[model samples]
Target: MNPHNARIEHHPVLGTLPPRKTIRFRFDEMIYEAKEGETVAAALLANGVRTLRLQEEKGTPRGFYCNIGHCFECRVTVNGKQGTRACLTLVEDMMEVISGKPFSSPLKKGGNHA
Candidate 1:
């Protein structure tokens, strides 16, 4: 599927939507287009990007389970800020989002527990 044309033009509840302002943002170093009012998760999902991040220890792939802010499964890095929830954050033009980075535990193995 073409990522550029991956938006839902019509909704069953909302009906046809008027054209929204298009903005550009970067995800994992790739540029993508999103509507002005779209959230980071919405924009990424519309572009066919399902895998948002990797599990901290297992490295398992993770995506948006609960679209609402309740579940933090959609957390990602935005503009150098770590642990930013994509589902709640709005997408801004020229915004940079990074995901799927290798996990590094704060406490080292056999380290002292102060």
Candidate 2:
């Protein structure tokens, strides 16, 4: 099962899982399908997208770490807003999820573009 292009077919304990309603969303200009109500981070991981963003100073790759909202490691740009936490934000149809780089800059706050 290549997660990069398809959804999970089966799980060890859960067995074969039923397909959920899928929605279309964009990641950096490429369109991807994700289950409705799933977090951006979850969807990304499902699609084998680990690196959500990169660190500013060092340009280190960043991906989903905590899976929860605490760490903020899974930050991405939704629409035009910056610093959007992928783990906390649910997937929406037609939503533009940009793989923002450096996560957040020390210079900006409140809005996207950092």
Candidate 3:
């Protein structure tokens, strides 16, 4: 576990969270450990990885602003796919996470979904 991780080690109401199976994954070329069933955002946060992506225009740093999937603040590249929502995507062993400038979006080129 990261020394500066922000994950909830102990909850006031639920007490300590039970240990879960561990998995190894990579984020921006660095390996990180995460619970098998946990979300990519949760795993990144647990490992002190705050900057999930950067603004395309100015390259401003962004991270987990909203825990849910609404904010789009935690968007990242998973494997070779871009615009993957980290908060809703489950972590898998050996998964590759690319953050910041490497992350891309189809909308950036005014592409239409339909």
Score residue 95 of candidate 2 by CA lDDT: 94
Q: lDDT by residue for model 2 over 1-87, one digit each (tens)?
A: 334754566989999967788888889887778888788888888887879988875688988788988897877889899899999
lDDT of candidate 3 over 8-47, digit per residue (tens): 8699999998888889999988999898889999998888
TM-scores for every predicted model: 0.85, 0.76, 0.82
Spell out the clash pairs found in candidate 2.
54-102, 82-112
Clashing pairs in model 1, backbone N/Cα/C closer than 3 A: none
Decreasing lDDT order of the candidates: 1, 3, 2
Model 2 earns a TM-score of 0.76
Displacement of residue 84 (Cα, Å) in model 3 is 0.3
Model 1, position 60: C-alpha lDDT score: 90
TM-score computed on alpha carbons, candidate 1: 0.85
Which 10-residue span in candidate 2 carries the lowest summed lDDT?
102-111
Q: Residue 78 error for model 3, in Å?
A: 0.4
Q: What overall lDDT goes with each candidate model?
A: 0.91, 0.81, 0.86
Q: List the RMSD of every prediction in angstroms.
A: 3.3, 6.6, 5.2
Model 1 per-residue lDDT at 27 = 98
